[model samples]
Target: MASVDLGKVLDKAWADKPLAEVLAAPVSALKGVSDRDGELLDEAFGVKTVADLADLKYVRWAQALAALDAAK
Candidate 1:
């Protein structure tokens, strides 16, 4: 299993949470993402939780594009 240092990616309040809880946390639970940013994402794309952001079609497309670019 791959171990991740959650403190590096999540906000302090979320760092100690379980994976499922973290995934269900609001986007603001991520490091450097403000509550306002979470609100904007919610308003724009119906993205409420980290899982919602990860599952977004636009995010998947962008990730694929970035991977293709990196492979070039």
Candidate 2:
């Protein structure tokens, strides 16, 4: 499985965008997200981007994993 490159997903170009705007992007923009997982994320949690995946109120595991990944 490919790893999610959060740096690319959360690129400098996205820095000025609102959180909602950032999260509105397609999940495919996230490095490791397969089409199937992206669909599941959207269907199950409404997650469409890195920000959405990192939302603590929704997918806590994603947030935790993101943190762990960042630490590496």
Cα shift from native, residue 58, model 2 (Å) = 5.0
* Number of the top TM-score candidate: 1
**TM-score, prediction 1:** 0.92
Task: Give lDDT tens digits, candidate 2, residues 28-48.
Answer: 655566778879988988877
State each model's CA lDDT, in order.
0.97, 0.69
lDDT tens per residue, model 1, 7-28: 9999999999999999999999
Task: Give each prediction's root-mean-square deviation over alpha carbons.
Answer: 1.5, 7.2
Off by over 4 Å in 2: 1-23, 56-72
In model 1, the runs with Cα more than 4 Å from the true position are 1-3
TM-score of each: 0.92, 0.44
